[model samples]
Target: MFNLIRKDVIALKYYFLFIAAYAVMFGLFTVSSFSPLMICMLPAIMMTLFASNLELRNKSMLFIGSLPVRRKQIVLAKYGSVFVYLALGIILAAAIRAINEYGLGVEFPLTSLNLSLSAALAMAFAALYYPIQFWLGVRNSSFISFLVIFLAAALIGGIGNMADSLTFDMLPTRAQLVIGLPIAGLLLLYVSYRISLNLFLRKDIEG
Candidate 1:
């Protein structure tokens, strides 16, 4: 399972430099208006898509299916890779946020709210994405992934805008939100994993 998780990372090793550069460029370009959440979450989402595309193109799943590992492990590894990408995104975003906040004199900081929201949003996205990807196959799921990405971007942007005007007094306390969202996201991911595992077990791997 760990090897499967590492395979996704290793497959994208050459692209990490490019990903970092893109993160920096994206942060600089959108820092003023975009939510910090976008910076933190988009990379994870995009990398998952890229990894899927790569795996599909290489027919990696068929090879993996022939190995000793169970379908359950494959599903778990894929789900685990989502977090690996998320952790990478957070690190990259934190660097960008630091530069923006201190070096560039911008006010955007890596608050707990931003971190929790990023985790929640990314997990929610994985929850929706994996089952579809497994059910339809990666190539067939491309259109759906794009639509999800578009909607996620729009939703997060709207949240960023709303954050400025919304009063915390009417909502749950900051601590509650900080705690609740990630928990919700994890539950979503668990449900998604079960669905994906079932779909994968039933899938026929084409050699």
Candidate 2:
């Protein structure tokens, strides 16, 4: 399982330079309270899609299914990889925030609220994504995922104004919300993993 996770990481090594460049460009130019959240999420989303598509293109899952590992381990490793991407997204987002706050003197800061929200949102997206990826297979899943993400982004954008005004100081139970979002996200992931595991186990890998 750890090796599977490491394989996913190594597969994306070539993209690090491009990911950094994309982050820096978006960070410096995009001036919105939501920008940090997007910065924190887009990488995870993009990488998830990219890896899924790559695997589908190469029939990698079929090969992986032939390995000594169990389907459950494969599913768990893929879930683990999501965390790796999320961590990368957070680091890049924080770095961008730091550069903007100090180097460019941008008023846009990556607040803890933003971080928490983004992390939760990323997990939420993953929860929605993995089951579909397994059930439909990656080839079809990518299109559906894109549609879902687009709709989600549009919905979020509609409420962006309201979200922009939100702050830790504004909420009565700010600490709980901050801590709870990620917890909820994890719960969602756990449920999603179970669904995906069942789906993958029953799936016809040779198809």
Candidate 3:
């Protein structure tokens, strides 16, 4: 499991990506709050899906299945790798936000909430993509699936905001954005994992 996790982590070109994402976050998005981090998550999701795709493409699943490990363990490790990567991204975002606040001496607005929200979104987005990649083989379904997911998120968010004023405002901003959003995102991740595992078990491991 440790080796599998390490392999998954190393397989992703994270350093170069971090440099690119960091540049955007610092140069253009230094002051902007959620948009930059939200936008950056798009790539993180793609990279994570691609990492899983690599294993699929290279026929690692068969080898993995032949081992003594349980199928759930393999799925969990993949999910765990996504989590570690997302955690790293959140840390970087926070560190960059701190630098911007300290260097410019301006507080990063919505610091904790935004960072947590971004981490949660990134994690869930990555997880959600995996089942599509697995079930549809990443070749056929990924383009349409990703397109629909993007559009759906945009539409839902827009609609939610539009109704926000009229909707009963029960939770504080800190609770809603900081705590609730992540919990919701985690539900998405859990669904993704279950669906992906079922798909993998039912379909050919050669995939």
**lDDT per residue (tens digit) for residues 1-207 in model 3:** 677788777876655476557545653455565544654354456556567557756767777768898777777777777767666555555565566667767555535676666767676665666776666764554474566478548855975787676645653566667877778778888888898889877876554
Which prediction has the highest lDDT against the true structure? 1
Q: For candidate 2, list the clashing residue pairs, or say none.
A: none
Off by over 4 Å in 3: 13-31, 39-43, 56-59, 104-107, 138-145, 148-152, 155-165, 168-173
CA-lDDT, candidates in order? 0.83, 0.81, 0.65
Q: Of models 1 and 3, which has the larger lDDT?
A: 1
- Please provide TM-scores, in order, for all candidate models, with all chains considered together: 0.86, 0.86, 0.75
Give candidate 3's root-mean-square deviation (CA, Å). Answer: 3.4
- Model 1 CA lDDT for position 76: 97
lDDT of candidate 1 over 91-175, digit per residue (tens) = 9888888888879887766788989988999998888888888888766757767877777678768877887787867667889
Error of 2 at 189 (Å): 0.7
> What is the per-residue lDDT of model 2 for residues 1-207, given as tens digits with 9 covering 90 to 100?
999988877877887777888887788876687788888887877778777767777777777878899888999988888888888989998888788888888876687888888888888877888887787777686687777688667756865777678896765476776899889899989999999999988977742
Compared to the true structure, candidate 1 yields what TM-score? 0.86
Q: Which pairs of residues have clashing backbones in candidate 3?
A: none
Give each model's clash number.
0, 0, 0
TM-score of 2: 0.86
